[model samples]
Target: MTTTFDRGLALLGAILDAELGSAGYPGNAQLAARIGLDQATVSRMLKDLAALGLIERAERVPGWRVGPGYFALAAAAGDSRLLVRARPLLRGLVARWHEPAWLSVRSEGTALTVEAQLSHWSSYVAAAPGARTPIWCTGPGRALLLDHTEQQLAELLEGVEFIGGGPRAARGIPALAAYNSADRLAGVVVADREFEHDVVDFSAPVRDPSGAIVAALSLAVPRFRLADRTAGIAASVAEAAGALEVGAL
Candidate 1:
């Protein structure tokens, strides 16, 4: 017979594996169905996994993101334990901007939403806290790429499929690679094809106590709607990133 921890670990792995394979992360019910378990049971295991410091469970309105912290921990071990450290500031940014904000990590060359915050106005499929977006197609993804060396960036992009038309999205990888520290400006545009609009995504890197760009903070504004609010948009996202840098994340 399997021990409780072993069973919980197995169940947690299934939920996270399914999440990784999905276009976006799935809800508790869907994860339950996939694992042939009940939602509450899956939730408990998820909580346990988080307790073990092996995973993160993002409980959002539409769904929850079961991300790979166990793998993250395994890769970096006890050194990179500050993911939970960034949640509150991300929350504050969402509250201040009344918009969706996210904390995401690049896992296995794929960008994963490890945490999310929603403004009161979130009713669309745009930027749910737990949703996964392509590193090749998103502003956060591009900003996240800026921290890599030329070879790493090229290798990371190799054979990668891209999604686009976001308000901040550049026309190609060359544009993305052009992002600089000089402007004190950073972010990307992702085409909001689902809503038939462009979403301006402004992003900045988040470093843990070790100062590694382990995650990013981003804001997605509707392009047509944000023409008048550009400065405020930039400031809010920059402020959010700054907040994370000072131990917020």
Candidate 2:
């Protein structure tokens, strides 16, 4: 027999499934239909979940999404052991360079930041977890595409308008391709004043045991702050990424 607890868990699972499955965030009606529950019941349960921070109400849209509490639980329980290992690495990078470090994964056509480490400085580039940035310009975004073929890149970018980002951001396929060529040759992505006018980023892919790119690791520094240490920072970022792959896997 299904218990109340079971039903509650089922509702939560349904919400996550809908979001990850590309059905977008499910509203009360959708959740009600999905889990065979009354709309009122679903609403009450969602309120409870939101209170617990397991989920959050969507902004600018009608639906729900994962919240920081979920990430906290996952990290605490070793559900995402990779991220646990990444925390120290990110800290070390920040300590060494006094720049911000980020861990990201491709979410459709954008790069979704899953982890971030900020420096103590008053002035520094920072991105919080769950922030999404354009794939056509950001270092972490480009790093995630390092293994894709030209055709795969084209297909992924199809219907995506080349807009936003700094003035140097890629405005078309040709420009993106040109940037990709240099990145591919270097085996890491170097995005200079692309995602943000004053920030420069260096990123490398994080691979799973099977040698497939699962995510990207990046460090962002203000252009003025970077000075002459660009090459050193880039190489260190790449090395740290490799270490993450090995240690996590």
Candidate 3:
């Protein structure tokens, strides 16, 4: 039986799907059409869900996206052992540095955040699990791609448009390839104002027992706040990544 609760859940799931979609977030009209509901009904339902914190208005964007509550529920229900193992490490990163920390894995040529530990600051970067970012640009994103060969990188990035990031973001595959080469040598990635103009990210790849790159652990901070502290922050991210790798296995 199609109950009211099921319909609400369906709406929430649809919004989350669009939030993670490469095509970008869907507005009310689009959501209504997709769900086969009247625009007025979708709007009322969205308002109710937003009030409950299941979804929210996308920041500076034109549509609805899943909220922290949704992620909290999803995390509780998820069965991934790695996510279970990573939560403490991410929390530790936040507790130590007072910065947001994230655990992300490669998905469909993008980096999909699977876990996040947010800082307690009144103003800080807002990232939630299920958010996706360009694999060629962001810190965790680049770290996730550190093991790919030049040809493999090219193949994966084929048809991808390099757009909508801060000034330092890689503008092309060649730039990403160069950055990855350097990251491979250094064993970490520092995305300085690459994903967002005011934020910087330090990340390291997390490898499994078989030495395969499975995820990336990252710490994000404001660019101004990172002054003269880059090295220590990068080292901490790398160390935490190592711990997560062992703990996950």
Cα lDDT tens digits, model 2, 1-249, are: 178668777988898899899899989899999999889988998887786567898899989987765665455345377787788888888889988898887664667777888775423443556566788889988899887777777888998788788878888777888888888877788899888888888999998899998788899888888889988998888988999899866
Distance from true location, Cα of 162 in model 1, Å: 3.9
lDDT of candidate 1 over 120-227, digit per residue (tens): 655453354334556755656656675666567667677754455444444555655554332233333332332224556666776666767767777666666676
| Model 2 backbone overlap count | 0
Q: Which candidate would rank higher by TM-score, 2 or 3?
A: 3
lDDT of 3 by residue, 1-249 (tens): 167566787888789788788747788999888878889988998987785556889888799898765664465346477777888888888888888898887765767776788776523443566566778879988998898887888898898889977789999888888988987888999988888888888999999889899888999888778878898889888998888788857
Q: Backbone clashes in each candidate structure, one number apiece?
A: 11, 0, 0
| Backbone clashes in model 2, listed as residue pairs | none
Off by over 4 Å in 2: 1-79, 121-126
Ranked candidates, highest lDDT first: 3, 2, 1
Q: lDDT for model 1, please.
A: 0.60
Preferred candidate (lDDT higher): 1 or 3: 3
- lDDT accuracy of residue 213 in candidate 2: 87
Q: Which stretches of candidate 3 lie over 4 Å from their true place?
A: 1-79, 121-126
lDDT of each: 0.60, 0.80, 0.81
